[model samples]
Target: MPVWTLYGIRRGIATTSWPEKEGPTQPGVLGLPHYHADRCQDNCRACADVCLPGALSFESCEAEERLALDYGKCIGCQLCTEACPNDALTKSNDWAFGVRNRDDLIWTEALQSPPAEEVTRKIQKYFGRSLHVRHVDAGSCNGCESELQALNNPYYNLHRLGIFFTPSPRFADLLLVTGPVTYAMQGPLRETYNAMPEPRWVMAMGACAVSGGASGGGYSCGHGVEEFLPVDIYVPGCPPNPAAMIHALLLLLNRASQHVQGGQVAH
Candidate 1:
């Protein structure tokens, strides 16, 4: 075998144990909102006033009152918590943001699995314990695929998650696609989807695939991935960080159990 092939095999073995434990923190992990009251002179509304996303807000009262922090809208940017004059705000290191309802996101909670272990075991039973992925670049700036490729790098080590990318659609269990489906790429995208065997999966990665992204309104753009293929998972973000992609993949892996069942899986 060639030196690079040997290296790849050794590296693959070294990282194959990742799915057994809690994964590493993904890039851009959302942190908690922090507040500092001492540095805040009560008149400084910079945090709440400057929030463009409206994730933070404050209501003044005659007596001492705590500033309200809405967890739902908070992207975990410490902007408000950081802008306080009295150093009244500080974010907790927690990154889990699972919620029961859109309103349930008003507060924070521990991350819940869709029963990840059970799902993994089920997939292992059906798919024979390994995953083969094939990535398709429908139409993107290459940023999403850049990070996708980085998963094979030392830090992310995606193979540890029992994931492998294949070059041929015939050997692929999952079709990991990025970018918006452009007019020119439409036929190729459909052909790729058709080429995959039964019991196949499609994961739409990035905002472009989810909704045509920045090119949604463009005359030449094909609306979205859904317009061309059935997406088993929707990983939303302009170019979602690799960790987000990993989490989304894991989520899909966990849902492979449901994939064995009938309906569509939309995320």
Candidate 2:
């Protein structure tokens, strides 16, 4: 038997005892949403109309002379917030949106602030003090890129966590790949990976990048990321909420155990 295969099998058995010993698993994704009433104008009902999943609704209160947002049905698209004439509604950087029950999806206000200090500490501990990332657009619809760009905003301030995105693959220590792997992108992806230096890591961000997602089995799809490159971490969800991306990046730095155990051993 080949040495690498034998070593892989042995390592698998030894690591199989992981979750049992590690603390309860952290969620792989998060989707926190926020509302800003101050920016809201009573005249705009665009949010109610634009919500594809019927997540947002309004109730007329004659006594209060205002409309109320139905927190339960909101899909966090932020379309309504963006469409509002008065700019009354706005979204926060918060992305830890989880609830015990399905009914908790609605937000009366922004959920609790993320543990910024704790996240910072974790990022520092995981990536070994300094980190540089190279981004690859495998085959995306550009939504993931939009959210990624937002990471540099004052609200998220990704740099504070010692994270930086490098324009050149040669300078990167981590590869932040987004989108499903498409036939056209296959060559570029491989070339980029080869360009990176040794001791590097790969983060497959978004559902498409992680598993082919909607593009999986599509005519143009190249199957999945694993077919092209070794993924050190998988961040699932369509254009994974930004916070989820942040958590996955942090996990890569910290060597957090993956959710799908032994599914894909890193090369």
Candidate 3:
């Protein structure tokens, strides 16, 4: 046997039991910036001005101006955290910011989705315990794909959960898509979705896949998968880490509860 195989045997299991229990994310891995409204300095738009993807914006309220944060558009560059003078927007490890409703990723609004009982029951009824996913690259910079590749690694060991990546859309129960939808890819994307049988679900896999990221509504691409495909889950990260992706998948299956609401992070 190879030296690597012997090393693995000595090291025992590398797969993590996460979601069921707490686990450590990569050290110093920057996630979304947290905004503390009380600490925000008045008349300052530092974070908003520095945000390239429009994740941070100034929302005008009656006689007051407040910053609006949309996690769906955030690439987790932590630029907002660096721009803040009052330390209002601080860096965090809040990487599991996935949700079924897009509004949950926005800071300024409260939008409730379909009741969990109704939707989750339907999904569980059709998909059962095993899920086969087909991933599509609509229009990407390849960053999301890089993160996705980690799912099958020894550390994550995705197959243990019974979720799999399939090559054929006809066998896929879920369409997990990354990147913004380019004009050239529009027809092919629809073709893939149509190929999948009914009870199929779609998941937007990144900031680019959720809101087209920095290239949203551009001449070459549309605003992520939501513009065309019916997205069942919206996972927002420039390239959400492996753990975040796992959480998103489990969330879709109703095996996990969402801790994010209106762009707020619980841990």
Candidate 4:
């Protein structure tokens, strides 16, 4: 037998059984920020004032005052946590942040008064067993791309779940996209999406792809992937960890349910 083959047999399978089993956990992984409107100061705008990406905003309503949080625009800097004088905002440990609709990422105290509705997705009917993804870098800083590469490592072995990274969009069932959509790359990104077959899906993999991350509308970059394509899944992070990415993919296929809703743990 070859030496490499013998070594491989000795090492055994290194793949993780996450989403299916209680697998490896990242240390101190911080996810979506939780908001406590009741704790918000009467007339304070501390969080909004220090928000670098303008994700936090104040609105004056006829009967009540409200604070709105667009999670897509947040880069998870946690600056808002420190900025809030009333401790209204705090760090979240929940990281499985894939959602079926984009609207789920936006939250307001006024609107959250009503109970959240259950969401249904038809992706599993078409892509339950396996999925092929075609990735495109619209205009990334490479932070998102680096985390994506880790998905294939021994620790995460994304292929174990029947998910693969395909080179050709013609054979792809999903478009895994990263970065803020740049004006120059918009045409190419659309072309890739158009090349895919029917029953296709698109995933906005990072804060940049979700809502332009720290780089909002600039001279060269557009706001986010949704501005150019219909994104079916939104995974928010400066660059989401490998586990979070896996959760998003499984959620896209309907193999798993959303755990984070309106900045609170759902499941």
lDDT of 3 by residue, 170-263 (tens): 9999999888899999999999999999888999999999998987786888989998989999999988988899998988888887878767
- After TM-score superposition, the amount by which residue 77's alpha carbon in candidate 2 deviates from its true location, in angstroms, is 11
RMSD, every candidate, angstroms = 8.7, 16.7, 2.2, 2.6
Once fitted onto the true fold, the runs of candidate 4 whose alpha carbons sit more than 4 angstroms away are: 110-122
Q: Write the per-residue lDDT of candidate 4 for residues 1-267, one digit (tens) a residue.
A: 579978889999877667678754776878768888789876688898889988888877887667888887788889999888778999876577777667677774444633433333456666788999999999888988898999998888888899999999999999999989898899999999999998788999888899887885979999889888888889987888788899999887777777666655565
Error of 1 at 12 (Å): 15
Q: What count of clashes does model 4 give? A: 0
lDDT of 1 by residue, 1-267 (tens): 579977777766434334355554544454555443445565566777766545556655666644554443444446666676666666544433222122322322223323223423455566654678888898887878898988898767877667888899998888887877878888888888788887887887765676565555377776567788776666544466676566666666563222111111122
TM-score of 2: 0.52
Q: How many angstroms is residue 103 displaced in model 3 relative to the true structure, after the best TM-score fit? A: 0.4
Where is the poorest 10-residue window by lDDT in model 4? 111-120
TM-score of each: 0.57, 0.52, 0.92, 0.90
Candidate whose TM-score is highest: 3
**Poorest stretch of ten by lDDT in candidate 2:** 258-267
**Worst-scoring 10-residue span by lDDT in model 1:** 258-267
Superior by lDDT: candidate 1 or candidate 2: 1
Model 2: residue 39 alpha-carbon error in angstroms: 41
